[model samples]
Target: MPTSPSDTLQRFYTAFSQLDHATMAECYAPEAEFDDEAFSLRGRDQVAGMWRMLCSATRKSGAAHWKLEFRDLHADGLQGRAHWEAHYTFSATGRRVHNIIDAEFTFNEAGLILRHRDRFSFWRWSRQALGLPGLLLGWSPSLKRQVRSTAANNLRKFLALPPA
Candidate 1:
């Protein structure tokens, strides 16, 4: 029997709050896809790796605190959205960045996530959270294009890697 989408979503959020990578990985279907502003990753392994990287970076930067306020849950437990905040110090600049973001999720049968997306404005985000560098560099069309392209390439590479 399949778990309800709401149940799956709750489990995912709990796992994320706990930073339980194994549990987080289990919440995704084998071929689940995730698209954030930074990259698009497909498959459980790739998504898991992305989470691992994010967790590591978060820990390293002392920004592991994640507070998720679920705004809505629907789609017969298959879809939902939430508002979240992440508080952390930037590893590169040691700047404390508090980011407010919106996240949405869709789950497949077997209680796994099929699609996950995060919404945020890169230009506004870069300028506000990232400071002068973000303000100056983020607005450059060339830089933005490069960032997107590089993220896509990285996701492809991650997907190509052998599963752990």
Candidate 2:
């Protein structure tokens, strides 16, 4: 029997907490879609690659430098939702960020995630990650676009690297 939607969500978040990007990626279906404030990605490869990149970045910050917490997970039929938070240092500025996120997911019949959307305040996140610049421009559309562009470029660079 296939795993239930709730079980899949639990496994995904658990893997994230452990910085197990491979397992987190496995939770997504082959054609999964993922979107958030800074990224809009389609297909499991893009989604998985993003997780791999992020987990790698988090790991380099040291195990004690970052933490993840998740709760309020619920699934009904093919849909699921969860609340998660991450406390970590932003590698760019060495600034500490405590990000709160709410996530929604749609699962395939096999319980792999078919779609994942994470919602968070970009202004809030920017304020924590960018320090003075964020405080001055976090709410501006230009700033948002710049962040998105930079994130996309970074992901592209990461994907270009040869497999380890």
**Candidate with maximal lDDT:** 2
The per-model lDDT (C-alpha) reads 0.70, 0.93
Over 4 Å off in model 1, which ranges? 63-77, 139-141, 149-164
* Angstrom error at residue 125, model 2: 0.5
Q: Could you say which candidate leads in TM-score?
A: 2
TM-score of each: 0.77, 0.97
Residue-level lDDT tens digits of model 1 in 27-48: 7899899887676778887888
Residues 90-152 of candidate 2: C-alpha lDDT, one tens digit per residue? 877888999999999999999889999999999999999998889999999999999999989
State each model's C-alpha RMSD to the native: 3.4, 1.0
lDDT of 2: 0.93
Q: In candidate 2, which residue pairs clash?
A: none
Model 2 regions more than 4 Å off: none
Clashes, model 1: 3
